[model samples]
Target: MKIAELLRSAALVTAVAMIPATTATFAQVDGRAGPEFAKLFATYQRIKASYVEPVEDEKLIRGAIDGMLAALDPHSAYLDGSDLQRLETMIDGNYSGLGLSVVMEDGAVKVISPFRGSPADEVGIKAGDYITHLDGELIYGGDLDEAVQRMRGIAGTSIRLTIFRPGRDEPFDVSVTRGVIELEPVTFEVQAGNIGVITVNEFSRDVGQDVFRAWQGIQREAAGRVNGLVLDLRSNPGGSLDEAVELSDLFLSDGAIVSQRGRARGESLLYEAESVYRGEIADDIPMIVLIDAGSASASEIVAGALQDHRRAVVMGERSFGKGSVQSLLPLGRDAALKLTTARYYTPSGKSVQEGGIKPDIAVPQLSDPDWEKRRKYQLRESDLRNKLINEAGLKDEELVEDNLADPRFKLTADELKEQGVEDFQLHYALETLRRTTPSAVALRR
Candidate 1:
């Protein structure tokens, strides 16, 4: 069967953490059905007739569908009932739960990152921690959907999570109160020296418009021209491909923003500057985009575009490389398939599949007490099972940067806290802006 026909969905739910949708009719089976199909049919017949117990057709069919997508990549999956509802909730940009982005790795539920200012983040839940149990019950080797359902509840309800931090010798439990997760896609403030700081928490609907308004707000608040701009995308899991393109268009007046290539025809497309927005809003303002290991998908798209055009200097550690594009194909009225269809590339023709977008300046977060320990065990797209390899043929070791001592970044977590610096990465970016002029900062490569 043709892949496109097998996967079809009514609505396309697209995000960095989840990319979804394509509408296509199933093609007729032709000579392409080789001996493998006959073998598969025989196996299915034998299982249906000779299993130890009676098996429902639904279970067997669903298993077969899952098995097909599982071999493709980690992002692709079958969505039904609660899964579909979850996707809708994400698109709507609100839900009641402990705000978190998680994934299943070897049957273990792993935390990707906690949303900033959420209950999970407030309780000191860091990324790369394994959630082995929920509410004192061992949940290891359980279904991911069940674990997620257990985590969700009405606002004000509490859920106890048993966490296994990799660097720690023992597992620990923490109680978190669930709350309504109302994501503010864009937030901004005018900092000292008229530096405009805009934090994009997630890329939801109208994100580009929100960012533009933020710039206007900063300019108005400053009562004059803003000295510089800091676009903080740390810990931002990507959402909405169109939003990414729109945001990139806001900064660049010309040139290709990003490109997508797929195996099938009509899947290749290029997005360029001035296509979404007319012109640059902050043309003369010195700009810095801060990204870390948690920055991914749509975040990478924005950062990569700005970097390629020399429109902004990207700072912080490397991003979570996730360059593939997933199409949400609807299987029927109540089910869908989230399938990886294409891989994206920056304007410079760089695929951030395994090798993510490297920053112009590598700035680590020194304000967190466990930053060092967490850094050693940090996860990224390349770390996932069955991840698409970069066509450039980069090795796993080569993708990882060696930890080196830096004289400029010598402050410890305690020292920074003592100095009242809550976020070392943001502080460093602001400091960099205060000291250097836009002309003084040169683009690498």
Candidate 2:
């Protein structure tokens, strides 16, 4: 991400109680230092007076504001008024732009996930797709936020995209009309042979409601008969922390869901699943949650919480270790600051900071075409970072196995023959849940 782009979301702290009560909504920031209002004005004058050339005071002041707020944390941020309003709208999972979740992977805005029913998703954008251009202008090697802002416009507006995908020669282009992105969090369907497959891609404000609706649909389709639920959390980078807790509450009871700790706050926040909404699934039904490295943040929150509470058997490798919580602080002019405030804990008082949550059964992902042995190249994290930085482009075939950090093991598909997990850890979880549930029922009786 470009510095300028991040500064676009800069935020300031709350004033002292003595300060005039403006908006009555400033986040409760611990204020010790008196107002910098005078110092701020002096700094502005200093910049205006001492420069060799008359620098744009407005731009420099904005940068200073961004710098001031960013020092707080990664999540507290200033928002340009428009950006602020958009941020509010985003909480509901709907935005009037190309529906794409992107990040700066290797100096370029790489597409992580595309929301279904959004223009980006409908245009066949997949996870890991690197977007190189918008409207024929090369956006690579520049501020990622600037590139993103260029990609958004009013709903029904047409925008162009240049993407690089694996096994493709040259970048491709797609023109899509931006539409209202209505995020559908959960969707389920009975797979062949009666496997209940549920896809939970991301969490938003609507996740709890969406999940409840999906559960109802699954039950209705089962027609008074229900099999085990395969709750898919693959490629889910996660969203709201509260929503993750709410989603976990759907299944768990009498166990912690997640916890948080900071400098002043040290007591463990145990989240027991209240019998808030009794459903037919309850504890008797066998359940499994599929996760991967892409399943991070709030996604890990849900998976870890459920697994700890013995609600769902988790499959796949260790989750993406992102247990830190970020608070979005509102900066002036619509930008905001995203500050990392505290480390969140699973209901069991565990933190997945350096070590991700270990699955009961690990299933490393193995795609065909073994490349590790062919290359025999041992690459460290720094090597990959350097590759992306120097290349300034998206190279897909270069994506080696993403499951190397698995809690169980990280191996590709062909490797499964000698050291294989063909069913992956997920299959093992299903079988285990199947056998354990019935036997547990027998014992309970």
Candidate 3:
């Protein structure tokens, strides 16, 4: 099926595509006896007959399936029942809970990044914090799904979270009241000097259209012509791949946007500009895209495409580096497999697997007080166990760090705060645009 159709069928599955029945073909299994298969059958038989206590066949089968998927990579998983329902709710773009993207790290639920303006972010729960307890009960080493379920509740309901933040002396407790998370995927504001600032929270359905509408709104709100644009993609965990392509198409009039390659013939394909949207919306305006370690999958797609075409100057830290694509293949009516099916490449044939897109201007969030401490512990796709390696053989050491001091950003966090700069990265981008001419900004490329 087309990527757009796959996304429409299951819109909630983030950074993944759904494999249609025709493309779900698999390699033929050898009929000859294999030692591995024999061993597996023997173990199953032994467990059924000789175990100390009786175990249900369903439990054993599910355990076997989970074990197989877990050994492959981090993002692959089996979804059924509540898991399937949750995925649907998330994609539908409305749910009642603390909006946070979390992952299982060392059997502990670690916060990847809290959605901006969500209950978790409002409570000051930053990324890399380990959630140790829910309602004063120990949750360490427990099932991550269970902990996540406990955190979800009706709107106005409260839950006490015990957090173990790195660089802290001890764990702390905070109570957050749940609210209906209506993800406004695209929000825009006309910044100072008629600069448009558009923030893409997550790549859900109709994001491309939303962004186009945002540009129109900015034009209406601006005093005159929009000078420049800032596309803020910080702390955004990716969603629909089709939406990513559509967003990228909005800025590019020609050239390949991205390509996906997999072992299956049907999975290898190319996405090009102008395929979804026509000519650029803000073609003449100098654009800047803000990204950080939390940016993944679809975010990387847009950043890489814009940077490759010199359509936008990508700023902020490197992205989360999730280049691999997951294909959701249904096992039955109620269950499915989220399997890693392909690795995506940018227009220049660069795979952002373990090494994500590097920004043209590497800017840091100096307004954050714990910037230094947090930078040292920031998580990326390279940190995940069994992650796919970049085809270019990029090493972890090659991951660029913005350690050099810039004269424009010399002020410390406290100094910036004193100067009324709450977000140094965004402030820097705005100042860069306001101070420099469009030709000067283009010269940086």
Residues 1-445, candidate 1, lDDT per residue (tens digit)? 2233223212232333223334434453466677878888898899989999988888888898888888888888888877776666555648889988787899899888888878999999987889998989998889888998989899999999999997787999999999999867799999999999999987877888999999999999999778889999888888778889989999888999999988767678898989988878878888899999988888999999999888888999999999988776656567767788889999999999879999989988999887788787888889888888888889878886857899988999999999999999999989888886655663222
Give per-model TM-scores: 0.92, 0.69, 0.94
Show model 3 residue runs off by greater than 4 Å. Answer: 1-7, 12-14, 21-27, 30-33, 400-402, 442-445
lDDT of 2 by residue, 201-310 (tens): 77755576677777778777777466577888876777776667678878765556777665433322454566344442445667788886567778888888877767
lDDT score, candidate 3, position 270: 94
Decreasing TM-score order of the candidates:
3, 1, 2
Clash count (model 3, backbone only): 1
lDDT of each: 0.83, 0.62, 0.85
What does candidate 3 score on TM?
0.94
Who is ahead in lDDT, 1 or 3? Answer: 3
Best by TM-score: 3
Over 4 Å off, model 1: 1-25, 28-32, 442-445
Tens-place lDDT digits, model 3, residues 109-211: 9998887899999999998899998999999889878888888889999999999887777899999999988878899999889999999988878888999
Clash counts for the predictions, in order = 8, 38, 1
Minimum summed lDDT over a 10-residue window in model 2 is located at 11-20
Give me the overall lDDT of model 3.
Answer: 0.85
Q: What value does the lDDT take at residue 182 in candidate 1?
A: 80
Please give the distance, in angstroms, between residue 38's alpha carbon in candidate 1 and its true position after superposition: 2.7
191: Cα error in model 1, Å: 1.5
